[model samples]
Target: MGKNLLFIALIILSGCKGISQEEKKEDKDTKEIAYAVSKTDAEWRAELTDMEYYVLRKAATENAFTSDLLDNKEKGTYVCAACATPLFRSENKFKSGTGWPSFDKEIEGNVAYDVDYKIGYPRTEEHCATCGGHLGHVFNDGPRETTGKRHCINGVALDFIPDSK
Candidate 1:
């Protein structure tokens, strides 16, 4: 079932034609920015794992507790799985006990948010500003004295490289 849905999404997105970076813009009132990716589903699937494709392409949620990134204590940047765009800094990662990898903030404006109606509730969907890979959702219920924004991310959407030296 999930595979079928992913194929449909791929077909729809593939037919969108080519979009250039210079044409990318956000609606003044909506604040929604269009993400342009030039990769096809076959190319993306060949490059990413099933779990990564599930989240990045199909928007399917993975078992938070089962993800390895949640327990990862490495010191490095978490980059986008699709395009290798630097999305989250290692300093912002925190164990929010939400099962998934959580972050207080992104590296400056690397993350973008929009309304996601996939699930019944009106949630804030976050994506990578570089390749527009779906990171996760942002919640208002976060730790105090910080940005107060809990970036609930899918572990498969990221690749952590431990810092050396």
Candidate 2:
């Protein structure tokens, strides 16, 4: 009976081992995909501000209605703070009232999407295609008159460039 119990425990442990191995394989696969503006951890830490590093590098969220960009109405382009990649244009900006800066569309190929399970469910996470900096999440609840997609972005992850007249 003791031998049988030990065999059963070993089988259960082996079954669990495959899950972590598969997860590690998936993580490695993701890391293999190169970005345009890659940087070492020290470089990124030195370049970005505290909030910017937290949101862009660590995928942290800012408080609602706390971003100055949320109320911005000027014509400009929003670029990635880490890589200066043009992400969203002023024309695409909208009032989603979710407190973060909301955009209806993104400059194509500037943003990448990944499935994030941080909130206990799968959310479409947006990142800068150039630097792989975390931008925010995209949702389906947007203006019906447009693409019906909301690119909910973190203000700290972006840098706004006003169009020169």
Candidate 3:
């Protein structure tokens, strides 16, 4: 009975993987998790630009102040570049001076959350619910007048849609 129990414990432990959200390159043996709009890695690479693929699929951060949409003040919506899932509204966007597009809130139910320790500290990682594309991280230091949650997003992971005139 003792040997049997030891074998069972070893089997269980062997099947478990670290929960940290590492880049796909680090764990090429694992399968991608399912999402509402899943696609093959080749399809994603063919669809997105190099930068977009890095930010959305590989979970990389873009350089600060490098996004064209950082200063966008027009009324519109921001959708996931990978899957076109609405993620944030223009009204929620604010100039946090973080050099990337910042928002106080997300379009409810359109975003998903996961905890990642890729930076040596646990941070709330956000993704597009439809395609599971990495959007960015959320912080607590935000305007107290509104949601008080600062969603620091990667501009390359999102596309803007101006309100129809």
Candidate 4:
């Protein structure tokens, strides 16, 4: 009788051990938890030009007066550089006179806000929620009727598409 009881306990423990192992295997097969674009750094460098890399990865700001899209009147979507996700639309863009690509709003729920202490004053900075790439900064001082916000984006983080006539 004692031998039978010990054997039963061993069987139960083995079954539990198998289940745990299976769960771990499933977890290993799953994707990473972070919201980063799937492409590697090398892939991004290959896709974008040198200037684009300077702004997107190195956080280098482009000249506001030189960006061709600041006064652009065309309609199209703005996509992410690292992941190519649709972020902003032409409709949201406006001339904020701040020398950056200004957007009155984002593409709804895609913008994630974080405290940017880079300047040492805790300003609000935005990033791609899908790939965790930096986009630009947000300010409360904007058009009073429209979204009550200003999304000052770096032109390097975006690829503009012109609308078809």
For this target, which candidate reaches the highest TM-score against the unseen true structure?
Answer: 2
lDDT of 3: 0.91
In the range 1-165, model 2's lDDT, one tens digit per residue, is 999999999999887854335442233125666888989879999999999998998899989898889999999999999989999999999999999999999999999988876565568999999988999999999998999999999998988999983
Tens digit per residue, CA lDDT, model 4, 42-102: 9767877887777776566777767766777789988777677778899888889998889
Better of 1 and 2 by lDDT: 2
TM-score, candidate 2, is 0.82
How do all models score by TM-score? Answer: 0.75, 0.82, 0.81, 0.71
Could you report the Cα RMSD, in angstroms, for every candidate shown? 13.4, 5.6, 8.8, 14.3
Q: How many backbone clashes does candidate 1 have?
A: 0
Ranked by TM-score, the better of candidates 3 and 4 is: 3
Question: lDDT of each structure?
Answer: 0.80, 0.89, 0.91, 0.75
Which stretches of model 2 miss by more than 4 angstroms?
1-30
Local accuracy of candidate 1 as per-residue lDDT tens digits, 1-165? 999999999999887876332344343234534556557679888988988888887777888698888988878988888887788888888889999999998877777777765554467888778766778999987778889989999998988877772
- Candidate 1 stretches with Cα past 4 Å from truth are 1-37
For residue 35, give model 2's deviation from the true position in Å: 0.8
Scanning candidate 1 in windows of ten residues, the lowest lDDT window is 20-29
**Pairs that clash in candidate 1:** none
Model 3 residue pairs with clashes: none
- The lDDT, on a scale of 0 to 1, for candidate 1 is 0.80
Query: With candidate 2 superimposed using the best TM-score fit, by how many Å does residue 71's alpha carbon deviate from the native?
Result: 0.3
